[model samples]
Target chain A: MTGTAEPIVMDLKRAPNVHAATQAKGEALRAALAAQRTGTGLAAEQLDALPVPHRRVERWKHTPVAGFWSTPEAPSVQTIEAAGSEACPVPGLHAYRMVFVNGTFDAKASDLPVHNGVRCEPISMSDADAGSQGPLESTDWFAALNQAFATEGMKLHVAKGVILDRPLLVHHHTSGENNANFMRHDIHIEANAQVELIHWSTASDSSTGMVNIMTHMSVESGAVVALDKVQDEAGSLQHLAFEQINQAQSSQVRVHTGTIQGNWVRNDLNFRLNGEGCETVLNGFFLPKGKEFVDNHTTVDHRAAHCNSSEQYQGILYGTSSGVFNGKVFVRPHAQQTNAYQQNGNILVTDKATINAKPELEIYADDVKCSHGCTIGQFDEEALFYARSRGIGEKEAKAMLVHAFIGDVLEGFAVAEVRMEVEHRLAIKHGWDTWNDTLESA
Target chain B: MVNIKELQASIGETPILKGLNLEIKPGEVHAIMGPNGSGKSTLASVLAGREDYEVTGGAVDFEGQDLLEMDATERARSGLFLAFQYPVEIPGVSNINFMRAAVNGKREHDGLEPIKGKDFLNLVKEKASLVELDGRLRNRSVNEGFSGGEKKRNEIFQMAMLEPRFAVLDETDSGLDIDALRIVANGVNAMRSPDRSFLVITHYQRLLDYIVPDFVHVLVDGKIVLSGDKDLALKLEEKGYDWIKEDVIA
Candidate 1:
């Protein structure tokens, strides 16, 4: 609401970090320019045609890029030795711990997996990395940016008919002054292959910093893959993350992303079904307290016959934190029998906090089921009253209804541990003892 | 747990219940029968502290406190339970979870820690059994997919769990068949004690046969026009409300 004609560039780095970041960004760009690598050539070309996007672009319309630009200049680059641990550790059964530090692959600290037909390779100039999420074609601008600049990125691929019971864990930890970390991961799976992968992004510090990352995923026909992305960065970091989804015919793709921590962050996700009978699910939950800002924009396109896409995002905001959720679903002309659903729901605790929700549906086919809705509400007053009247207190009653509102989303999640832990942590953010005591009259 | 004196209540510009009076003590079941538009449900809503219904003229006391002054939830927490004729179905909310919150809410008000998971589960189990509510229904979302009988039974089950001091059975028998009615009545009968009171609101005497009320009142034109004993309910069932409105309140 302020009057400003110039790009509101908020400097993020102090003097020391800024100078090193400039040099690192330049070196990373030079590396990609030197490589004549293989990928969807179109992806790289798209990256070449576009400069670092500014506020002028409509696609990046609502996002505040100043948070990314005005950041304290990049911190001085530290060698892998200077940073103690490779990546933040999460306990579970992980087959491979692929560690990336400052966008460079730390091979010495990384653990390799024995699963056949699955390859984890680091591509700089001559090598190429691939994985099951999707094949990164050369044409994706974001992927190209990562390929040119990524000091370290992983390529994971699954062979047809191979199912890995354990999760392939990818860890990202960024540290240092001369930091311009970019990564492009190309994932591919043979037809009829099934893969389960968890991409864990976390930073060691809650101090102020910046991170911008994108993942490109393309799943082949008859392939089924379940992807879980968790963002558990500290509250003082500025995070700009994006993911692109491309699905083939008769394939099933499900994505569950939870925003566990961040000070200021914006994530964009796009899912496209290119073949018949493809099913894509894009679901997310964001819980922001304090002065956190978490924005998520998603688009799903049913481009072929019999494709189905559903998007549901739940947000719980407290304090002066604000959240924005914008979603769109499109049914192409020939996409008959397509079913697309999108909904965004937010709960605000304090008066100063705000939620901006927008849902849009575009249908070109007459015989399609498309729906979109957005709601900004607190816990249901009647429901709360009903519980309290049973002799429950105000705090306890509100907590009951809040858990009730989010129970549906948590139930739909595939990972039990993630869902349970999310509920536990979210309860804390809402300032309740348990899931049952954090509600107020909304 | 119940006291009523010259009870007067209204809604907006029109008066719904005018100069109505009734009384009940713990350990007694009273049935209030009336025809449509006779302020039967209004009595329940007003007692439950529904803000839309204005209690402009009547003085109501519940368990010795000013009932009308409290909010709906406060009224409920104060031992006033109204079993809605059409139970509000909260989507995505399981019955077990809902009851846990409610029971724990009540306990917390009494300065108690939350019910343990094991204890709460068993509590719902035993109470749900009282109403013969299907065990499977307890795990499903609250009233989300319930049938007529199931919804009524769930209402009674809720009452049993909360152990309200004064309960209003608003049209509990309206949609129930003979079997469901009998089960609901049995649950009510099981909960009868010297410390609790029941007000059964119905349009017919058939429910009276199951609930076996100690007093019967005929309500019409927003007022309790006549009061009698069990025999009065039999009389109204046979004679119909047309005669009661014309011969009594008028």
Candidate 2:
């Protein structure tokens, strides 16, 4: 894997003498992606037209995707039966299901739902898997690699005023070999339409590789959509899921992402509130155990007037794992009365575990109630001692305190089954505390 | 449940408890009244297995087991509870989850299965009303913005929920108002049993009027200087603790 030529590279905006870091990573993504395909049908000039943004791109400095992709990537995804899907249920999801094995969308093992306003289809089905899925915008080398050797991905849309009765569930299950899965999903919720979508991915021990994924969400006027994405795959899987939000006037969108188990999981959720009187809420909970690296970065743009947005993301990191969170609230020069508030709090149980957080506020207009705060701390010692003195052992005591740490975010799930699902994953991720002498000690 | 004989304790290099001895059987309520900086809190801390306080020389036997040898959680599992004078605030964690973990945790420690969800809710509701704590506050962050009286009431609510065999109420009456004081006293009264014991720590004698202590001990500096029946609280109330410090602790 080492001594490999230019691992992965990106093509920045091609400015006059870009920053040295950006230039270096751009070269890396280029080399890493070259092995995917040798100018496969798409001419070299056309591939050059593709967009892959590097560090200098806004909101990407801290995440550092250049180092995320391993030197030698995984084998290709011939096909897969995403196991444990039936046992891990999604009841209200009635839309067409697109199951991915490694990275190819498998329509055989899925049930496609029909509705007047909704359409779910595999993009490669019509193109005979030949046409290139036009360049990934502002994506990194991993995403570019996914586009290079990609097999199949999904495209979903909802018609205006035809609010679907159920959600569309997509299962991205990886298995059998160490492989690279690159996927790009384009989602559109038309005007005055309401929809719920869930992306659940699962993997076992054999599924070891890097997952570079991207999702684009566009909501028209008066549209409402709730998105919940959970990654409970094998702990050895390194993955990335990036999402961008394009919003219109009076559209309400709530996106909640919960990751209780994973290896290296980084997500960038960028929301552009391009209209006035728009309401947006983003809350997430990440409970990572072992040596997992979870980085979550979010940016909410107050592009219009009289708009309100709230952001809260909390997580509990245990063992030797590390987590990073950066939440930015941007109030454009004229976006007055923004009423934006953002807070991120985390608890590190073991001394070796760590969480780095940054909550920033950029307010351009006056008379706005925009405030942000971030905290990375240990559990309350007194509170732990109190619970322990009441017969809870060190681990359960720590879990109890941590359960308290993410209680607010967990309560915001709204759906009983989904809330409990996330909570159950949390319990399992930290379940080691529920075993051993400490379990009996409690 | 607790039986201590001539217990001596020290903080850092200075001694706080010197030859202090007491016996608390089930169903008996004993109050330790002392002025500020006395070993009143120290006694409670040591009983709760707080490691900061040194047991210079003492033997504390609870339920026929070596109380001082057990860790904080072990001592608690063996049926001991302490209501702190100041309950630490744990932000972002709801009261329901914390309470549920605690109840189930304690039950698990007793080698008993976890309490059912419905039954636990009923118990929480019953215990919550016993202290007049609002259900809405249970949904709020744990004491994140609770008032002084609310914290005290919360301590009592916790005590009612755990139902410990021996409880050490460390200054449970300190920041409480008259109404809160009665509610707390009523909660303790409801849990009174021939199989449960209490050690109330307080400064003002007002709390003694509601949950009257069976016996009162006036502590000054680091040692108990005087010990008497419940009337001793009223007498000390009228005469002031400085006099008791002069007569007994001297």
Candidate 3:
């Protein structure tokens, strides 16, 4: 019942000296980007001047970034042995798989299916072909770090009126112990283009690396995009990811972020509705067991009129794990007739577990319907009794109830195979008999 | 068979069932008619091993096993079933999956293999039709958004699926329309077997008219005052419980 210990304050300006090897790698990446004239990299001085967030910062209060950047050894981008395409976690998932190992693109380990009207390739600093100024680039500390140090990522472009038959998968596999990997992915969806994007990560059990990812997406008019991001890294790994989405008029976007297994994970998801008649749907769930910590911060800013956005995020914490969820919705004065709703729900399975949830809504428009709420509660005893009375064991009943609590968000996955894989993993880890798995096998 | 001897129970410090006694042999339907708060539901809950009702002193034997020693799940797996008066509505747990788990749980308890998927599906279809439960209700979350009659029928539907040796129906007739009452009664009647026994607890004699209990007991103040045949129910329905209360007092 006691509060957490006072956060440790670190002198980030002295970080360059301690992490000199990482700084030198960033300089090399900046030179490469400058040579290609991509204009995506920040100057060395600007990158050094960006302040790394600490516990004192308001947004970073719940999730401290100092520990995310701290390591016993100098964190540098390093490549290890590649396990080929068989290393893909979801073997049954059939997608255009692009595999990356320790933040570097592995061409031999990826299946690059060439389809008409789709340009998907590993971003190269030497080639200017897969180049574009992305729609949204955050000046935040984490994004700035990624912009300065990112060495390898993917650039995807879908031509107008093109609908992908299969999903595009960006799979990150980490094997570098005590190392840092920075990745940045750019996605461009032309008008009327429909595509589904899946970003998934897995790491070796012995790897205690740091993986920072920044994703920027732009959707043109009448385009529809579905994004499913899953982070199920090793318990020793630390993960920080930022996603920025810019929607044009009449664009429909849906995003589902699942932090199923991670020791420390922080996600910042922002949506900017820059056009009218756009529809934005955000659904996410996190399961933090043991001593894991997961923090999710999201913002949906409606700057255009006649836009609708709905966000729902929930988590279940067990053992001594803790979680934090902060969802904010801002409806500008000019964005009349905007309907924005946000909800955050959590369940603590153990007395030692905790969850801090805050849902904020700022509606300046008069003729708008906006609602935001949060709920933190324990398991439903009556429901538990009901299931057990029907002959289900207590532990199995609890497992089923936990899955049910997060079912709606998982159902939002654009790919069925991906959903089943994640569900199977969770069931195996939690000793749950997933009925659908049996039904499918039968 | 089920036997109860000096069954005493309570909630907190307040006693609900004070030394009630009852016994049921195989192939018999015994209906206990009582006034409000006469420990009718308490007896049903205690029989089903509901944790909230503590058995302060008493003994319950089910098929040669000490029933009170088992938890609710163990009792259920050991062939004891209770159709709740107010069936719990569990959202996000489909009725099909719940029933499958229940059926498999009992089978495993009896050292039998799990039911085949096709056979389970067939059983669900067959048992559901007994109560006129539609396919949609079978697929939806357990008892969620179900009407009163539908919830009761679902209970009987589950009873048919589980096929427990001893069944307790706690106020199964309340809040039911005449048509639904007949349908529910028909489902229960169809499941009557020589190997199974039932304790039907209700306030009205209306349900007795359809199920046709072999014996009728009048309960007042946590004790049974009189026991009779089917005609006693009609008499109690026509005469109202005042005469019985007077007789007990005298």
Cα lDDT, all candidates: 0.72, 0.75, 0.82
| Ten contiguous residues with the weakest lDDT in model 1 chain B | B101-110
Runs of candidate 2 with Cα error greater than 4 angstroms are: A1-32, A35-77, A82-96, A127-136, A139-151, A176-178, A391-394, A414-416, A432-442, B10-15, B51-56, B91-101, B109-113, B116-145, B238-250
TM per candidate comes to 0.76, 0.85, 0.88
Q: Indicate the TM-score of model 2.
A: 0.85
Which has the higher TM-score value, candidate number 2 or candidate number 3? 3
Q: Give the TM-score of candidate 3.
A: 0.88
In candidate 2, position A100 carries an lDDT of: 74
Candidate 3 clash pair list: none
- For B1-250, candidate 2 gives per-residue lDDT tens digits of 7788889999899999988888888789999988778889999999998888899887998989999999998887788899988887877556766677777778877889988777877888899999999987776666779999998888889888888999999999888889988999999999998999999998888999999888898877666678899999999889888776566545
Q: At residue B27, what lDDT does model 3 achieve?
A: 93
Model 3 scores a C-alpha lDDT of 0.82
* Candidate 2: tens digits of C-alpha lDDT, residues A1-442: 1222111122243443345665565556556656654423333443455444445654455455555444545544444533434523455434546677666767677665588978767666644343444444433544445555454567777899878776667778776554567776777789999987777877776666677677878899899988878888873777888787878999998888888778888887888888988899899988877888888977787888888899999877878888889887888777787889898988887899988788867677787898787888777788878767767777877766666566667666635556666666666666644411122112
Q: What value of lDDT does candidate 1 attain over all alpha carbons?
A: 0.72
TM-score of chain A of 1: 0.79
**Tens digit of per-residue lDDT, candidate 3, span A70-184:** 4324333333344322446786787888888877787766777588898888786436443354322565566776776676688888999999998988888877476567788
Give the residue spans of candidate 3 off by over 4 A. A1-51, A72-86, A129-136, A437-442, B220-225, B234-250
